[model samples]
Target: MEKQTPTLESSSQPQLKLAYLRPGDMIDVEFASATKVRTKLQLVGFDTGRYLLLKQPNPRTEGSYADVLFEGNPVIVRLVLEGEAGECIAFKTKIRAVTNFPFRLLYLDYPEQVENRALRAQKRVRTHIPVDVTADNNQADNTKKLASGVIVDISSAGCRILFKAQNEGGNVTHMNIKVSIGSGSQKDLLMLSGQVMNQKKERGMISVGVRFTDEEAHIIEVFDHLLIDTEFEC
Candidate 1:
């Protein structure tokens, strides 16, 4: 896949908060007006400190909010960073421009500052656990496919898994998957459900980051067992 390099802004603004964002990431935009409209839009591109470009909301679905999308309107933007750096970022800016000629697009003034909060309260612990991960394919058929991988590190919130690229194809974001722990008998298998948050592919292998939707108690149980096993072997 060809990665798009975001347009770099001038050096005048040393602290470019929006530089961390990428095209196609979902952003929550709140128009600070009488109606206080809030909606989600996919990021189209950005020019560092100059402007943040976003795909205009679909006319058929989100045309109602067009009234609040005028120039100089105050806007609050937010996006969540998944994977190792789990954080939610928010910034304040204004609608810089809006266009519908060639394409429907919305532009906002580059934020001067950004605020972020950590999503994971607990620190991640490093370990290796053999497992089987079954991810839902992004097709109309809704097939369940399995892959053998190793959970390289984990925390109460999520974990990172390493598996061969041939095991699972394409982007796995938002795909429902189950991490099966243990082996041999059916009773020995401990299944944990989660959605694929992010992935990195290199050297014929892919690293998957997953945030578990299972209860904290269950995660703690697995965490304790893994830790104890590690200590015993040490």
Candidate 2:
């Protein structure tokens, strides 16, 4: 799908953290903020401190790919790495002006600065399953007990749970809740420290926005797929 040139500051643009990119990594690239069709490209090689060679994502049109790249012109790119979909990086860059017999690929100028920001509309899904929450992982708090809640919505980074309105104690704001979500064998029991970013009370129902804290990247990756594929069935 094409993307609208984000109507935000350049600072919020995607910034490539070299740590996330490698020679073989692939990135979705868009041209000129005027078009939304992003081209998938592979990082075939780089000239270290100079330029980068990328395998074009689309077929060569009637015109030369080099002409389309608009050598020396600025370009924008998006990267949705693993489960970090909550945080996508869209940046502006330029393809170098050099045109030689690389034969089948295009070379780009090394990004001096790529603005990194969240996606225009982050990937979040509605979950109809109930999620069990243990406010305190410590079983010692038999008195405090698990707070039963239904997961109303979920994202790659966190979930929103609908719970009893009375549980809006101040302590629940950043409480570490062991959330058990999903159904049947596909169910997953995970320990997530919840950051209650928002809370709403209506009709005796309390919906709390909980951001899962300190989850390992790999775990988030697994959750992202499940939330998208299983829970949301998308």
Strongest candidate by lDDT:
1
Candidate 2 scores a C-alpha RMSD against the true structure in Å of: 17.1
| Residues 1-234, model 2: lDDT tens digits | 443443326554244565556566677766654454456777777775577778764444533444356566566666654322345566566777544454557677776665554442445576676667766555755525456888776665677788776744453565666666654545555445556665555567666767767555744755654545423322
TM-score leader: 1
Q: Report the lDDT tens digits of candidate 1 across residue range 1-234.
A: 332222223222333346657677779987765544778999999886588899888979767666676898787787876545457777777899999889989999988877776677755567678998876444537656568899887777788899888843788877788888894444577778888988766678888889898887886776565552212110
Show how many residue pairs clash in every candidate, following the order shown.
0, 11
Q: How much lDDT does candidate 2 score? A: 0.60
For candidate 1, give the lDDT of residue 37. Answer: 71
Residue runs of model 1 more than 4 Å from their true location after superposition: 1-17, 126-130, 135-143, 148-153, 160-176, 181-221, 228-234
